[model samples]
Target: MKYLIILSLIIGLSCSERTLLEDYVFDDNDISVVKHEILSSTVNQGYTLHKLNLTSLKWFNELLTNRPIWWHHVYVSVPDNLDSTRPIFYYIDDGRNNETESPSETAKLLSEFSTKCKCITVIQRQIPNQPIIFTADPKSKLRIEDDIIASTFGLFFFNRTLFPNNTYNNVPLLFPMTKAVKRGFDETVKFLKSKNVNFTEKFVVSGASKRGWTSWLITAVDQRVIATMPIVFDLLNWQKNLHIQFKSLGGGYTYATYDYFLVGLTAKLDTKEIREILKLVDPLFYLEKYSGRKFLLFSATEDQFFLPENTKAWWQDLSIQTNNQIYIKRLANVDHYLNQQSKLQIVSDIKVFMDLMHKETSSTRTLPILKWYFENNILFGATRIKLSNLGEFDSYTVTSYSAKTKDKTKIDFRVNYLLDKSFVDSNISWIEAPLIQSKKSDLAAVNEHVYRKLRILSIFNYVGFYLDVNLKLKDSNETLSISTDLNIIPEYYPIGDCYNEECLGKLV
Candidate 1:
């Protein structure tokens, strides 16, 4: 059954189980290497950057557009020590077909990471074949990024007829996007083998925004991905997170999420089809498959589209918590971009964490461990946070941002000036949090406030502050970060029948 399949393949997979993601299979023809060629190769920052053109397959023929042939701009960087046994870092990104095709952006971050990890790095672009004009209406165009995703949601989720002429309906934009990544990897391996290059076949995948969502989805289906770092796309447990946006943003999602709003997706969120769609896309259902995988649930504190508190919805729901390593890395005063005012962005340290991931199995460099200081409020939540392996760290610090406001009943952190880096610099500061000696021995306590014990049935701030615990590696400038759970002071919906919505509450 490895024949070419359409995006509508998902409709045939409507069963409500982990098998929703587990059972997805790409056709051999979908990932078949139609062509893969190295367009150019150059040395930059001590790494070889190879610009490659990969034409994987004819995704949807005579359906959405006349151009069914998928074209991908892939860049592979070779580290100093290229071994077939070492893991590879694959970053899935989105770009326009006509944009400046340069690998400088990936070089900026991955060069240092390549040196540290000594692994092959790859960046695949033009995820959805951008700047695409609708087949029916030539004027109706779609650009790269979330807008493409939103429109795709319109067609597949609601089965909207944007193009009146086409008989094709419910063709998902999700399937081909994932195929591009898997095929890119397949082609990369093919080209490498042609050049007598070696790869481990193991992958550590990372991507931002829509690509980040794809990263999670691809990992769900592809066991090749042993580690996944999905950046800034934190809306996991899709059904609940979507509704929480309404709760956190005062009964409406942020304007930045207008993409979802414009396509009438927000209206169908409560529908049965959308709920079924969430099962296929949400990474939560695929947690059991991630037992031995390493995960970095990367987040941005000032993200306009997603709330910081959204993580609470799914973090505790991760039944595989003990079976996997899930790190919550949050940056303060940064928005969806995760970069602001040349500020020391926390993502700069991601290279170190990734380096640690490679070493987890092969080298002596081990990742840090964290613990919850459960005194008496184990049921309410841990009162304090603890960082173990103190002797291995050079130093550490904690910072927090309060989502609370003057009204204890309301918590609104998405102010208008989130984009103005200077505004955050002057007004809202994720100030250094004070560390206290833990009640438990051999643990370093990292908490913002002078600990407050939660009594049974006692309500705290409508939404309290969340802490980011960062620890520096021994004798190096590199650092790793993990955050305490979002302090969502859950509230009841005035219009809806929802009740007792804990921070980790599940509507689905």
Candidate 2:
């Protein structure tokens, strides 16, 4: 009966409205123009830049059809002297919720890049009392659960006539924002074409921080995007990275409260389940699937949001899997904001990569690869895997056999540390060792030299785990290491128990 009412409400919408909803939901088509007007234009640094005010409508779902939205399009054209055959570079501006009227500082920075390369910037205007689309805010009336159900059904209906074994519900948390941004870009392209602006189909998508995350999503779903360069954003390996952040900086550092927190999907699911859902929109999934595209990851060593270790680990894994199609550059001493020198270096790197890409015809191009190696050792309570480069490659994969069944199960390894050589060389500790994970089983020592100790810290007041290890390396030197893991059991406390100050205080 409820579904009937929804279907009737959808059917009652105007013809144009129904068409808009049908096009957005059923067809993977980009935005069709309802209205477009150039708000302003200025000639700057040998290029003509136009600011367009566009009103567009897209189908959100059955509950919300022909959803009206607005966008600010900033289009920059190639110089008169320069050939119009240049590639297009599209950037999504992160307005930071402050720039309500004009583009943010990052958008201006992209314009500077536009002086040399043809650039298009898409910025979503903040509308007062606008319905929340991207985030599954807990306080929202529509609720995250409803959004998930609608999206799942919508996607399934669009993709398959008959229901399959499993439905792809891993749609990105930022799907609405990314989709709107993509639509705006598509509209801008059409507007440019209408104005007789000549440009190549080779599109490069780049963004910084949150916008960087969007860039990854845009490139993943949109085949029109030929290359992607994301700054200060690491791949989603949420289980390990989120756990570390939660322990080090409390629950707030993970940004779990944000609407885009895996699109609020994690609130109801466990770690493993959340990972499965994230596979729909995670950059790792797309990067691996589209291994032929050019990917450049720019990160800072001292970035507060994205840990340097996690960034390196993600890059290492991607490097191995993608066969070095991905290029990574980690700047030392630079934070996420990136100072003047770092910014200059970033622009230079972009130019270099784009130039190389323009010259190549094939999708698969050989990029510089990082050399590294791994070793797996069976330990008492956990598997210890060591990854070392030291100017040479030395990595290995570990597989475990069950004692009773003898069935081989590959151990999933997560790095806990990449110890510095200087620390190990000072007669202080032996070779660098990293703690990894293996199949859950009875604790037993596979190596005579390695010893493991585990203890549960306070569970009533504050939940934590302490692990201490003493190991003798190949050189006969022994060292002791201590690590801690902290988490709140979901069943004990509600899923988002630590989100607010009041709830957090109660946990103590």
Candidate 3:
């Protein structure tokens, strides 16, 4: 028994000696910027837009035939009234590099955002440095986001059939991608300091889609990131996500996840290697390790890649770790490709959250507190919501409730009046089925023929219904939108059953 214990301890120490995925993320003890050039600078509306090209890393050794190096053309919009006290609103976005669009056109909107918010904005492009070719059993050209990630994951698996040569061994591409972001930020800071500008090192990290995924992981290892705004990427607790996404879609993966499915990455979902990978790469695994970190999870109800049922499985865990500091925003009637309105909505919403964080940093304010519950409605033969701390929300008057509910319940309030009057109401496509939309909208598009296909596919296969509370700041025009966790109906989907034998009851 003594020999066994000693041997186990030695093995554990050896495993701990292995370089963690986080170690690779900021692997910059040796790397230096190959080149950083300021291509152009423009002053627009109290913001200075500086376009820069920064080549940062030579990652892993080489993957089969592709170069291990990467570069990004960054756009940093500096607010003229820079507040040293506030955390920089750093947005990490992914789009085509500078070669695709003119520098002026690319930097315009973000520069406007900086001018309006009065905060520094940084956008790093070409994050994964794509168009990478890896020659395995079959040569594959990876450019799309998921294709890039899964292929590197394939290398980690040393999945011989996919990566026949396995020349790169098992170095993940994610590390290099994350390292690029950090390096870009470092270079930006150096550039600013060289130009005699100074501000806080703290940041509110944010990004959309795959960048959003990186935003979550960035906060995990980078304490400099004081808060995170992960948009359109609700992929926390990935093991459960894989199981639930499959189970909810009637035991099949969504077409949106084609890259992961194609690479046979989905095939390895149930394996021990994947579990080991999760320890290194999964965001939720690091949540407890870095508690009290602020998070605002922005999601879409009809996101093509992620289902609405997914959030409920992991939300309780998130709220607890963040001490209820985490908030949620679920845009209605939108797909993964967010519409123009949704895009503007996201920025407007984030602006309010940004102000909240700014004030909290100076100890002038704290995050709003609100609570809720469901009670049996005897008259309606259904459930009704009873808010616990309604008074805390600055403008959550009884008027916010629709006219139907106003007559049903004696509450005198005005969502329109308390906030701005011209609230842009969303179009609702309510099919009205089990575990689907629970609220009634004034403009319900109940045309089954016009929406029958969507109902057949989405309503039956997916559900994302939740109530939200909108609060006004004490004296600001900005409205804060925080969502309750998605309502989960046990029967709507098999929340308890581990239908897939490989899942082994990993369902949360």
Give the lDDT of residue 28 in candidate 3.
58
Error of 2 at 482 (Å): 33
Candidate 2: tens digits of C-alpha lDDT, residues 1-508: 9999988887667322421112222345434544678877777776666777655444343333223244444445444444455567776554322235666555666666665544443334421113334333344443332243335434433433332343233233355556655665666778778878766655677777766877777776666777788887774665455443433333333222233343333343343545554555456655444455667777664454565445533555666655656655555446668888877767766765565455455553323232322222232122232222111111211222111101111010111112232211111111223344322231232311222322121122222111222221223232111111111211132122232222222100
Q: Estimate each model's TM-score.
A: 0.79, 0.56, 0.77
Error of 1 at 424 (Å): 14
lDDT of each: 0.63, 0.45, 0.62
Q: Write candidate 1's Cα lDDT for 162-201 as tens digits.
A: 4454422325566667777887878888887787777788
Q: Return the candidate ranking by lDDT, descending.
A: 1, 3, 2
Candidate 3 per-residue C-alpha lDDT over 45-94 given as tens digits, one digit per residue, 9 for 90 to 100: 78788889888788654645365667777888888887766777777766
**Segments in model 2 whose C-alpha atoms lie over 4 Å from true places:** 1-35, 56-70, 96-100, 118-173, 244-273, 363-367, 370-508
The residue pairs in collision within model 1 are: 462-489
Candidate 2: 10-residue stretch with minimal lDDT: 403-412
Error of 1 at 324 (Å): 4.7
